[model samples]
Target chain A: MRLPSCGCCAIAVRCRFWESRIDMPLIEVDNLSKTFRVPEREGGFLAAIRSVFNRRFRQVHAVRGVSFCVEPGEIVGFLGPNGAGKTTTLKMLSGLLHPTSGTATVLGDVPWRRHSEYLRRISMLMGQRSQLQWDLPALDSFMVHAAVYNIPKDQYRQRLDKLVEMLELGPVLKKQIRTLSLGERMKCEICVSLLHGPEVLFLDEPTIGVDITMQARIRDFIGDYNRRYGATIILTSHYMADVTALCKRVIVIDQGRILFDGQLEALSEKLAPFKVIAIDLDADTDGYDFAALGDVLAKEDRKVKLRVPKGAAASVTGRLLRELPVLDLTIEDPPIEDVIGRAFGGSSGVGPEEETSAAESQGGDR
Target chain B: MTAVARSFFAFLRKGIAVMLQYRGEIVLWAIWGLVNPAVSYALWSAAAESNADGTIAGFGRGEFAAYFFAMMIVGHLTQAWDTYEIGHLVRSGEMSPKLLRPILPIWEALAGNLSYKITTLAFVVPMWCLFAWLVRPTFDTSAWQLGLGLIAIVLGAVLNFVLNYVFALVAFWTPKLDAMGELYFGACMLWGGRFAPLDALPDILRWLSGLQPFKWMFAFPSELIMGRITDPSEAFRGLGIQLAWIAVSIVGFRALWSVAVKRYTAVSG
Candidate 1:
């Protein structure tokens, strides 16, 4: 409702405008699905013995009938719990994996066809894998990358200079990959991946296993690169700081299907529409009947915390102030982690009953 | 053409850097390559000496020695390790990054094969010269014949590369390709003259070797250089077979590569 001011808001507005302006999506996914056949085995040793002679296979639907689209120059967070198909979708989109059914087009080319033109425009960086020639220096790997993408010599040098300066990789570029630390190697990997100047980037847990300082630096570098090059970025990370720091719109999936695909603010409002009210009581609060006012989350010797519906937060505060000997009070939304955890079927946020019903309701939308 | 050359050179440079770190492994593999021919020379030399005519399949003592010594050099020159390398890459999920690249992954193998030969050849050529000094091998061919033999050797190297590449692609469907590799090497050993000269192979195996591509890969070039096949028509026919097999192997490679990539994407997904 308010005019945009912050960098993220401006990005959101710009992304929306571009998304509306373009007739064709830069990345279009239509019911893209992948199913894996895993050999099934029982727990008992006898069953395991039987399985060798008469093997049984089970089908795992890793990515199911899912569809989405991304406009150019947009940063979208693809978030899901482990085994929720985030990485699977990324692989399919990046042409590493072929879908079992349906199709996906990146830069107007079928990803699975793996046209050289299509590949030149996209890059994928997985945290678990290393693209660098391990025995060679990162600089040598950069030249190999430039050759692979056919970047002109002058363009390669200029891009390499900018990346090295931005990533603070001047000192480590000459060292062998085996000699570099994990953070240093990751920085080099990112630099080499971008030297070709791809228009689309699929980053899967790029900051995983790195230290906090390095994680922050990489996140900032990704933002800077995206802004500088107008690259459409799809990122998946377990670290909340990464998602909050970079993505304005998040696509949350569970059980191999999208549960929510919209703004982060809207997700919080829809999933967790309650505020936590904490009051510092003057004395032991055991005597106070706080359960009638709201769901009491915690009751300490001198303070009590209650979860109140957002609409009734002001009334509950007024009643607590008028009736109880409250010294001070504060209201806060539930933590984003808790909201995400609940969305992922993790216990400890919403009750299990509510979590199940909420998941069921959203499951059909896919 | 310039872009292709640049990428090839880039791959070559990076591949050299990688091979340098494995210098120890290169020595061990070179020794392994040499041992096969050395033992064959020893066995076949004894066999020739024991014959009533002091010759087996028209190969006297000097001829047997010359055949295997050339066999060792040519075998090393044309050997391809893509079967094991591609198997490891696919099984360990390392092929993901390669698939993401614009260039086909086969270029990496080709560059690696060339760089490895060049570096180890530093030692291999000296070893060859030492053997030549001791054995005093006879030059039995003209320059034009040697030139044609060299072209055949190059095409033979490519044929071996594509052949091993196609064999390695089977790893995408099955996890274990060790047995397959052993089977392939056994066939090469029997029919490709690794154990003895192709002239020493039994009639059926000789027929089979002539029909297949392995003899062109290993024996034909050595025989051409050693001047065993004196008939010009036979020499030209060998070269023609090498070219035809190279073409066939390339077609097979492209077909298998697409299917293997599809299988990899489907299963590894």
Candidate 2:
């Protein structure tokens, strides 16, 4: 094998060395495990009273032997369904919860140790909870967080103005958090989280319960923040729109394990080998067997969609192009949600047939 | 020095701003504080009037008012309920955002507690004055007694905060902290010296009560103010007891905090 030149080799070695030292890995996780000891409760007043004396605990492994590293300035979307340990992983990284075993490091510090240096440099925003004190204006909440974060006056002002301008908070910053609409409050939450200019931003469903327009705006701002500060962002969201808009790479985890980790396109290429084929036939055709080409994903009024295995797609298209009086035809990769669902063996929503088709489609990637 | 003072004043101003907004809740809880003392006052006054000696249990009607009245304000300032609250947050996966902030949750809680006192004292001060005017209690205050009273209150507040924090740390070990709350409240209410002076209880009970950290929190402070411990030597001894409890609490807090965090289930974020 041809090797790199000495100058290039030196740079490569230096990069490897830095990666090894991990003085400041934007994100680092090593064999991390979190098992929740759930109290076993049986229905009835007797059991409740008995629990007072004979407490029984059963372990639920929420996260098991998970390990990964994220470099600075990288936007990695952690994808999983409910009970898939996605939120658990995010909590561990943000130091909201400690791991039962192994280690995790952010900015060269152990996360659960609650070191101030690490905390000052990172911010965690969850879509379901209000970090800002409610019953107060966005501006008031921002002031409180600014104090708690110990943000310098000048930096706080500059960052606040920048966020307010970007998020269009001029009209709503004065409104009480309770008064603001869901979309509006989400923006304000993001603003407060970023007020201190954190180097690492952990967003757990940051756009959940947001409208399409607000979601798009928040996604755009996240991209902007990353571009401006080179901040390392680890975001967890169930919505495909979030990952599609902002992340190039995604980590698919389920049942406390990482299922897939790579580029977004690579995910589809590796898991979904079938390209969806759309047909608009002039003549009505019911009971048509497109499964000969691959598997049928859906159909609507003279229009049909079939996911054909990658190699067969072109050949099948040629046959349908020749045989049917097709009004229009199109080819595209399956939806990311479908591909991800298929990757985790229909855990999200994809069915067995679709998973097989997606699996075959990914085989075509090779 | 000016810069330090200015920045401190800035924190103070911000603290005041936050305090005023929660002033409503603070006033409501202060009303709750008034309840127990008010009940005790009525009960003791009735007993004093019915007594042939016209003095029930070494405390006359006015003396009972002074004792319970002082208690109302002191207990309010020194109370903490975060042990169960924090546990609930951790168990329900709601505490992640708090851990993410640069400030410790304890620091924020402490600041909020201190700020609440500063604002709510408005009503507390006024109510005390009105009560004192209505049934004036003759106070015997020398320079030493006044000094001791102030010191006792301050120490009591610190000791209360530290002990409450120690109990809160238990949330890391046990998720069901409501039971812990019940146990702590029961112990502190009786042994903590809030109901009556530990000294007034029978010898065995009083001695056992003395071993408890609660009496130093409220009993000694009320006694110092009431001039019950007028003997200079005894007053010094009371101060010593309060100081010793404070030391035990601080030391216990340091040890408990680390162990509790270690045992913390480290809930899935």
Candidate 3:
């Protein structure tokens, strides 16, 4: 006798068969909110003693009415500040948490239900947490992972070899996880998580606490993994380079809500509607009154930087060239970090059309 | 073998390897397991010898030695620390990765529990033999009683593990469970026959012990191995009660685990 493909029934096989026929988002979340009831107490012994009979609690809305969808093979960056619910949302998607309200489906199954099949197809790596046994070698943890995922011996060996080669983990495989450096441990973590070839990957700050060179290497590995396997990845990183390098589309979230979602390049256009013009003058004109052109961001010996509205960038540059002896001139969008800071600071001067609401951003795919 | 069984064995192997790295600490813990039984045996035997008939509560000094010796073995085999461990895992955000696995985290915890027992056996078995030789414990157990006693020990271990794990689920609701863990251990010491034999307890306390599952986990197996439960019918009845409590504990575990996972906030990350 032979087992079914799913080791269950023909109906499940048919369901998979039909699932492949239709084009659907690999992950779909709608109004997914999570509120935590956190205990609160005042300082001092008197307040603490009084709180034994009457305790206080504050409800924290960690993720409120957030919605999003991810297409297959898309590396979407989940950008947010600390306590902005990025990890909370990922935890819910990875089945580590239950939503207070609303629903989410990953690979056509409810995530919080934590079905074995769903879990086998997805992996979430939290940089602060160690999936590997601290006292054991990386290889031991990998073997345990293989057994838990029920990977075939041949496939496990093949994937392990490839991941080791890709992640440069061969030297660290035999070293105890606690003895390894943060970068080596992170590489091992990535290697073990991908041993089973998860279709969906959630990486929360995968490059955190590592050197710039290691962060770049990890970023490159993530990009290569996404391309080679076409795995849909949702990455959260404090490093802008990680997002800008791997994710063509970025989701900006703040205060438990999605502030903006679309192409990474569109972020500046929507949030910071200004162009920076830097000019190198032939001679220093102390009385030129450069502020008359636009907001003089900086004025020095022979170089002047101006922040002009997007609509006035062309005219401002023509005037500077016509009046001043311009040696070289360049126009560029503001840095992504500055734009994000402004957005979070609520000083972006956003219009109704540019203020992409959480609901609107749900469908604002690239 | 099935995938779950394979995973369990792998976890067990890894747990044993981890335990070997902390040999000194484990030796101390194993010694501590012996101290409780040794002190209880010394106290009870001294009291029994003070009696005019060389007995207290129908237990002679040799009988008391046998009882405590059996208690030591049964207690070591049935020990579970999840009630102390789960709170730390939940509070420290360490349980998240374990929960991500396809299998329940309890299987890994159970493997770790067994690994501690298996690794400490080398250090503890010698100590047990030394104590038994020094005390000259009497043994009237027949081969049949020994066979049934082994089965009771296995069942009692399972019952204790399941019950402790079920109680540990309270950590999901209240992560700081040190007080709870201490309270649970205190209850086991009093009601599970670790402090004194159920036979020597006050009539009301002994009657209460019969109604609780702790006595089934510790006293029944220890008594059967000590030849105190001589009647075949009574021994089998004790085994039945152990099985029943195990079944109830497993059911309770299933119910509590679902609610606990939902309640998990994955604090700190």
Task: Name the best candidate (by DockQ).
Answer: 3
Instruction: Quantify all predictions' global Cα lDDT against the true fold.
Output: 0.82, 0.75, 0.87
By TM-score, rank the candidates, best first: 3, 1, 2
Which residue pairs of candidate 3 clash?
none
The residue-by-residue lDDT of candidate 1 on A195-225, one tens digit each, is 8899999999999899999999999999999
How accurately is candidate 1 docked according to DockQ?
0.54
lDDT of 3 by residue, B212-265 (tens): 999988889899998888899999999999999999999999999999999998
Best-performing candidate as measured by lDDT: 3
Candidate 2 stretches with Cα past 4 Å from truth are: A1-25, A40-57, A273-337, A347-366, B1-19, B22-24, B265-269
Better of 2 and 3 by TM-score: 3
Q: Which of the numbered candidates is closest to the native, going by highest TM-score?
A: 3
What TM-score does chain B alone reach in each candidate, compared with the true chain B?
0.95, 0.86, 0.98
Task: Considering the two chains of model 2, state its CAPRI-style docking category.
Answer: acceptable
Give me the overall lDDT of model 1.
0.82
Interface RMSD of each: 1.5, 4.0, 1.1
